[model samples]
Target chain A: MKQAVEELRRQAAGLLKEERVKCVIGWTQGTDVARAVPFFATSVRQAARLTWTPFCVNNLSKYLLNHRYDNTPLAVVVKGCDSRGINRLVQDRQFVRERVVVLGLPCGGMLDREKVLRVVDPGAALQEVEDRGSEYMLRTDKGEYGFEKREALLSKCLECEHNIPVVSDLMIGPQVPSPAGSGIDRFAGVRELETRDPAVRSTFWDRHFARCLRCYACRNVCPACNCKECSFEQAVPGWQQGACWLSKRNHPGQNYLFHLIRMFHVAGRCIDCGECARVCPVNIPLRELYRKVMKDAEELFAMKTPGTDPEEVPLLSTYRTDDPEEFS
Target chain B: MLVSRLLEYVGLEPGRFEMRWISASEGGKVAETVREMTERIRKLGPNRKMRDER
Candidate 1:
């Protein structure tokens, strides 16, 4: 793991020194041991601050959208899931592919923040994380600790479909084989809710959404959620009286509307990177909602997961003449 | 669950929402689902869960 970090820093420094990129976006140990915040290294010297550890859970690909208009190229560090998001952005014509340099990282799962917070000392700064075959060794300023992979890894990582980026301009580490994942259905979380009665499901969702502060972390973190003028931002140019459906009121209906519209908008486009769920402060199982649409698109439309193949037509854009019409 | 919520939010009754399950081997499961949905609709009668937006 330390070798990977050193290589990444060296590569980032060279990119900055050569003027190949204006900035290198990666993760740095945050204020505490449990957190890994996005770090932007704009100079060769600043590259040394970059680190890639098991705590690097962010889909940094979304930040590239911020640099889309900049003249200088921006190099981004992306894990397997984050690279898929980059594919979505490129395929959507959000920005030209050549404008950004992709530095891929071979991921070996990641630790959940909440779980780490419970065990670590207050104000402890993370020093290093050693990836053992089936466990992780967390070395903090306080002390070194070990955690079994099954108990520590994020749910998204536990059923990770890809450990290496499908596309990469440069790789920081050698390709690592994904761990054996059995009985971990991506849609199993949704299936558990589907078994309940529809009203019961409604109640279940409402209970969760009611806790929403509408901070929009889920919206902002989503790589598929780039829009010039979001409909939720204000009254739109066209609509029923031009009022946005989303209201400032903290009503349960408003919460559902906000989340439901987001889910629908990203229906065919979401890469299932799990960033939305990860960033949500209120702990909504947002991936489950999007995965339901993903499941439906697969089963009903015979569509592949979005962003996996940029050449393929989007699921909603292309249609078969004999496509399922029973829903209509 | 999400789709049904979207519909109901806009004043459409969730009971109007539908989903299909296909299996040539499981006619009974299909019939039971339909029967259960029908019963729920009957008991609930008409849905007036719409907000008084006006």
Candidate 2:
């Protein structure tokens, strides 16, 4: 990991000094090695803060879509799953591929915070963690402990195939072999619900949507949900005005519709990077919504999204005259 | 409305297509649109056949 950081430091400094990129977005130590936060380095000095480790789970490309700074080409460090998002944006023609320079980092797998929290006490002030081959050595205020890498790994890591990155302009580190099926069965919960009657399904969704805060964190973190004006915020006939907040009967069925419509809109385009699920404060099974859509696209249209060339017309935007509609 | 208006402006030959607006307020419009569109599609024939002849 240190070797990768040293190599990235050199490359990032060069990109900044040459003004090739307006900024370089990468993870940096946040108070501790266990809490790496996204750092945007505009200068060579800032590049020194850039580091990589198992704890870097947040998809940094989402910061790029936010346009938090002035619109300029950015140099971003992307893992395999993160690269899929870049591919999706390009495939959807939402962003020009030329604007970003992706530094593909071959990740063995990232630590899932949920999994880590399950093992370590939530209040434990973790200071540093050393990657010791098979086990990670940790230093916390409570005490010191060593944990197997497998135990702390994110659920997504269990099925990761793109740990070394499928696409990047400059690659660093020797490629590591990723697992065959990193738990990509994103629709397990949804399929379970599908077996139930309509009333049962309605009750299931009612319980989940009943807890929604309407914070829009799910939509905000979504890579494919880059709309100028979201439909949920509209007034005058207001599709989802009264139903956004978390209250009984206030949310109504529109909350479910809002989710359904959004999922369908990005059906073939979802990269399944887990950003929507990660960002949901209320912890709704949002991944299940899009995962079902993705499964349908793969089965019915034989379409794989975002990772392909930009010229291929998306399934939603294009249709066939001889399309199989006889079943209807 | 957009579909009908566009087809009208283009001056398409009669029976080339049919268009309708199915509002959320109207439940029957859903079935009506589906039936009407199906009829128009049948009249126009299969799209692949039309493309091949052209």
Index of the highest-TM-score prediction: 1
Q: How well docked is model 1, in DockQ terms?
A: 0.10
DockQ for every model comes to 0.10, 0.03
Index of the highest-DockQ prediction = 1
Question: Global CA lDDT of candidate 1, please?
Answer: 0.80
Per-candidate Cα lDDT values, in order, are: 0.80, 0.67
Model 2: per-residue lDDT, tens digit, A1-328? 6677788889999999899988999988766435678899999889887877778877877777755334587898998888877776676556567788899988767776655666677677765555665566667787787766667676667656467676689996656556334456545555665555645655555667667676778878777777767755654353344543322233535455456557666766777788788778888877766666655566566776445444556667778776544222
lDDT of 2 by residue, B1-54 (tens): 222221222222334445445568988878877777778878866632112110
The sequence of per-residue lDDT tens digits that candidate 1 reaches over residues A142-235 is 9988988889889888888777886679999766667436667877776777667667766677678878888999889888888966767755
TM-score, chain B, model 2, is: 0.45
Judged by DockQ cut-offs, is candidate 1 incorrect, acceptable, medium or high? incorrect
Clashing pairs in 1: none
Interface RMSD of each: 6.8, 21.2
